[model samples]
Target: MDYSYSEHKQCYVALDCIIFGFDRKDLKLLLIKRNFEPRKGDWSLMGGFLESDESLDEAASRILSSLTGLKDIYLEQLKGFGKVDRDPVARTISVAYYALINLNDHDKNLLPEFGAKWFPIDELPNLIFDHEEMVSLAKARLRHKASNQPVGFELLPDTFTLPELQQLYEAIYETSLDKRNFRRRILSMNVLEKTDKKQKKYSKKGAYLYKFDEDKYSEQKNKNGGTKMMFKPPKV
Candidate 1:
């Protein structure tokens, strides 16, 4: 059987990925310097045209891996971008996806080859064509998702200290959190398992290290009927 829709116009479809990473202090965006035409040498999100043989998610995953040499990354489809003149080169609609990766886990050597660099979320450069908008939307989605779920753990190391976890939240929200209250709230959830280990990097006494208990969290979520895990700021 032959499929034909000749009456309608045809346009190119692409997938853009907003790769986010946390370096224990700040939230960063992985961007690539475009070496090709239509804005050569400008900073842009890693993206590729959607292929006939792959789904949108697969396209996003492929593009992310091609640029970062990472696999099994946490990815979520953000939104679709389609404007008459969004792409100057051609009539293209891009599906945007955001990916979270642990900074310490990615392949560093692949970055240089793809002209990729991590930029602090607060100090990003001027991006090409509505990419800045895509980034802004992605950031909001990340903050929202992190608040309702344990997705923020994707940006942290396998094992982390309480302070490190707090820092990650602060970086995501771009605000300071009350250490005492924050610690209380997080522990009250009972989703973290304390390991018999301490991190001596930030403090003299060292903070106890902990890891997210996925099984426990799932059980808790089920018991609570799918309640969201939100970060409540301490009242001043």
Candidate 2:
């Protein structure tokens, strides 16, 4: 039983990733200089066309791994862009996903091979196509997520100081945080375990290092009816 579907037009589907990393102080986005035509040599999000046999999540994972040599990364599907002329080469709809990676973990060598570079979120260059809009949307989502949850930990090292953690949040929010209030709020969450080790690089009296207690955090969240831990900024 063959059905004739010649009357309808088909468009290509692509997965575009807004890969974000925090370099201790500033939040950065991973962008590639497109190697192929339609917009060759222009800055674009890391993306690839969805294959027939894979789901959107799988496609996004594959693209990220191929570019960064990373796996099991923190990824979230953002939204879809379906403007008819978004891609001049073809009628295409792109499903955007944003990924957070610890800047210290990814393979630095792989970036050059793909002509990829990291740009600070605040000072991004002109991007090709609808990519700029995708970035804007992803940044908003990231800010909201970070404010309501501990997802920003994905962008930090396993063990970090309170100052480091606060800096990461400040970078994501693009503003200054009141250090005393920030520290007090985060400590009250009781999801961080203080370790004996101290980070001595920055101070005469080293700051204690703390690690996120994921299991404890999960238990607390479950007990609280799955409510997300909030990290709201203090009133100025």
Error of 1 at 207 (Å): 0.8
Q: How many backbone clashes does candidate 1 have?
A: 0
Clashes of each: 0, 0
List, residue by residue over 1-236, the lDDT tens digit for candidate 1: 99989989999999999999999999999999999889999999999999999999899999999887888989999999999899999999999999999999998999999899999999999999989999999988888887789999999999999999999999888888988989998999999999999999877999999999999899999999996565664322
In order, what lDDT does every prediction score?
Answer: 0.92, 0.91
- Residue 195's lDDT in candidate 1: 100
**Collision pairs in model 2:** none
1-236 per-residue lDDT for model 2 (tens digits): 98998999988999999999998888999999989997788999999999999999999999999988899999999999999889899999999999999999999999999899999988999999999999999988888888778889999999999999999988887889889999998998888999999999998899999999988788879888975656885332
Error of 1 at 177 (Å): 0.8
Clashing pairs in 1: none
